[model samples]
Target chain A: MTPAEDYELPAGPGRNDNWQGVTPRQAFMRGMAVALTVPGIILFASAAGYGALARDAGFSLGNSVFMMGVFFALPAQVVLLDQIARGGSLMAGTLAVTLTGMRLLPMSVLLMPLLKGKRATRWRYLVAGHFIAVTAWMEGWRRLPLVPSELRMDHFIGIGTGLVLATLAGTWAGFELAGSVPHVVEAVLLLLTPIYFLLSLIASASGEADRLAIVLGGFLGPPLYVAFPGFDLLLAGIIGGSIARFVVRSRGTG
Target chain B: MTSSLHEVTQAAGAASGTLPTGLTLALILTVISLATHEPWRWLGLILGRNIDVDSELFRWVRAVSTALVAALVTRLVVFPAGALGGVPLLVRVLAMLCGLGVYLLFGRRISFGVVTAAVVLVAGQSIMGP
Candidate 1:
């Protein structure tokens, strides 16, 4: 066998490289099915939290539930609500929320390589980009390396559609069940959203560098908070990631 | 006319009472705008990626993207709002750190890290008597 064949360039299933006997469409559908199934429980937790937040903020159940569907960015939505609750200006709230979402740009950039096909038209990405989030992004990063370039977007679409629907349904359930929940339970429930996100991060990370980045980021985070307060998280992540990346790259080069 | 901070907050509070259908509609429009821009963005990247992985422009893109995600995550952890805001900063940090430790010690499994962090937080709270 040739070196490339022996080494296995890491293409998707049924793409002749992996030899799992699946078509790209089948692989994509399978990936989507898996994605849809995995996030249901996690999404339920997030929905419950969102429902509680909406109730606490005095938002109508419909509006709160709809926001989850439309915005689909939890941090931004939380920022918008908190700023509003604190009596911040509407313009200010909007600005903060938008700024918080600035990550989407880079996330899209990093994710593009995995989701883009060699000959796929631009329209595929346009739709795929909407489904980009922490969960979807992590999954794409993990699975993309093995996927055929042409089938990545389809796989992503399948996964993204599942997540979108799950979030919608979860939010609806949360909205309906909001007031019925107790305060302590709601507090614990709210913690689940971030916890789910953190879990996703741990799942998709592959290298020692990523592991170090997460650990250093977590450790340095609190002290940074004490020192910089509002800016701790930004500083910790930037510093931790930079340090980890630099160290890893240096080791690789050396 | 320029309004005072209090006036602005009051106006915002009043606005909050009503559903932000207009804002939501505007957000939808913004999504459309972003969608329209995707083609050009993709084209630029495609051409760029073809050049070389070591190209300066490629590195710049990677750096910018990583930085942006880090910034967002940082913002959330440091300046959380709503219920997360209710949690003490030290506790949050400790929980996160403990989680990270678990992740590192456990072969980088995310579930381990998350569960460790959550368990620590709950345990700490219990020990401290709520």
Candidate 2:
């Protein structure tokens, strides 16, 4: 097994034991380096796409770029923009976008333990949670175990900073280009966001359960859309996840 | 219809032709939405003994979050926006599937999956029109 595959550290050290080896600063810098490479490009492209979509939907360059800085979550931003375009009530749009962001809560909770030091305070978690996007989460999952516990936070900060800066710059660039670009270019640009997502999913899938979840999710998600239309995402996710859990459980028992 | 267009232009000019106020409001809402997750994180800290954010509980959360994000992306692709909005949904879905299939068949390389999917999409769109 590879180094990533061989190690499987629990979220927290047993008792209050601090991790050894790397310092937070070094790890953070390493993470930043990684972010600047493959992940940075992806984030830039995705954010640019968001800018283009926001422009196409008739949002201002300033507002679109501003949202990228503040919200940071793309899916919720997309939902919010789409709802507003449809003349949906501000309250309704807010609620929908917020609901879409509900997933972040758990994600933050899960990542906190990995990066938190034995003596770490609540405030640290609160701040770090802001950087908890899919890219960071996956990187943390893979790299946190390898680094000395003390340095995980630094690694995360390094990566998170790179990602945030890249996203911010990309969003602004896309917004500026929105008006001048043709519609087809915008469509393809927007399409790149999802394409990046699909590719990332392939990269992150580990173990039978994860594989099962993706396969089930992929097969079931599209069909559910055909049947339930707008509600397919929620329904298909619930069904796929439950099935994957059940299969994993059965296999364990057997 | 002509009069309505004129009215829209007037409104657009008055608003500095910027994004609609409702969208700005929505943007504000998105910013503050970060608070919603606070309560849950705190709750986990308080009651869930040994439940650090990195605990199994959070791992499940991360997994679910990953899936949800994936689902949203898939939704956008399957039910696109603006110009490609007119492209047949099946074609988009097929392109994604083809890309995914190629990725899986090639040992699940991220670059391959993304590039192949993107190529398939552009190629399919060009050949099929729209």
Candidate 2 residue lDDT tens string, A84-163: 55443446455545444655555554565677675346676655566666666665666677666667777777777778
What is candidate 1's TM-score against the reference?
0.62
Model 2 spans with C-alpha error above 4 angstroms? A1-29, A88-102, A118-121, A182-184, A201-254, B1-27, B30-32, B37-49, B52-71, B86-91
Residue pairs of candidate 1 with colliding backbone atoms: A11-A146, A12-A146, A233-B74
* First chain TM-score, candidate 2: 0.69
lDDT (Cα, tens digit) per residue for candidate 1, span A140-189: 66666676777777777777777777777776666666556643344455
- DockQ list for all candidates: 0.16, 0.24
lDDT tens digits, residue span B1-130, model 2:
1122123334544555343555655546555565543344344434433544434444344344445446656666755665556455665777788877876677655556666766776777777755
Interface RMSD for each of the candidates: 6.9, 6.1
